[model samples]
Target: MAIRGYHAHLYFDPHEVGHARAVAEAAQAAFGCPVGHFHTAPVGPHPRGSVQLSLRPEQFAQFAAWASEGREGLTVFAHGLSGDDLADHTQYVIWFGTSEPLDLSIFG
Candidate 1:
């Protein structure tokens, strides 16, 4: 099934912090993906975290571009979460791709 969009919790290194935020604001431009939700951290070790985001339908091509020219980052696995998990600060990206029926409840 072709994915309609994507929901993710993209993380970043200190240098990629501001640039990662820029990805949300300029999704179409930066990643050829649409941006949504975009809830930022209030106060904590995750001061640079953004747990809400939605990418566009053209994920393959967009990801291709990213793979070719994007910077490097880390990804946290399913068991790498801490505390609320939603706001865990792992200094890396903790996002997943979705197909058709996206269940935001899983993350909440």
Candidate 2:
């Protein structure tokens, strides 16, 4: 299935919230993608506090590269939005740092 878009979740702890906001703001400024709320608590299947960046398919490569170098010490969980939540979170995912275990049971 063709990916409709992408979601990159920047995971952070309370101590790193400011850094995460800076990273997210910088990405929004640079890439013109919409940045979601700075979630201090886990939302959906995310395992930690996270900020979500929504990107178009055309923006994926550049954003991914930029994020790789710009994420500081945060773990980035990126996945393609392909309709099927399970496949999107599993098969179509990419990680920019140490991967974290997502609560995939939320998808079921």
Report, for every candidate in turn, its global Cα lDDT versus the true structure. 0.40, 0.93
Which window of 10 residues has the lowest lDDT sum in candidate 1?
Answer: 74-83
How many clashing pairs in candidate 2?
0
Off by over 4 Å in 1: 12-17, 42-48, 64-108
Per-residue alpha-carbon lDDT of candidate 2 for residues 1-108, written as tens digits (9 for 90 to 100)? 999999999999888899999999998998999998898988899999999999999999999889878888789999999999999999999999999889999977
lDDT of 2 at 99: 94
lDDT by residue (1-108, candidate 1, tens digit) is 233444444544455556666554554566555544433442222234344444544564455355333423432111122334443322222333221222234454
Model 2, residue pairs in steric clash: none
Error of 1 at 79 (Å): 16
In terms of lDDT, model 1 sits at 0.40
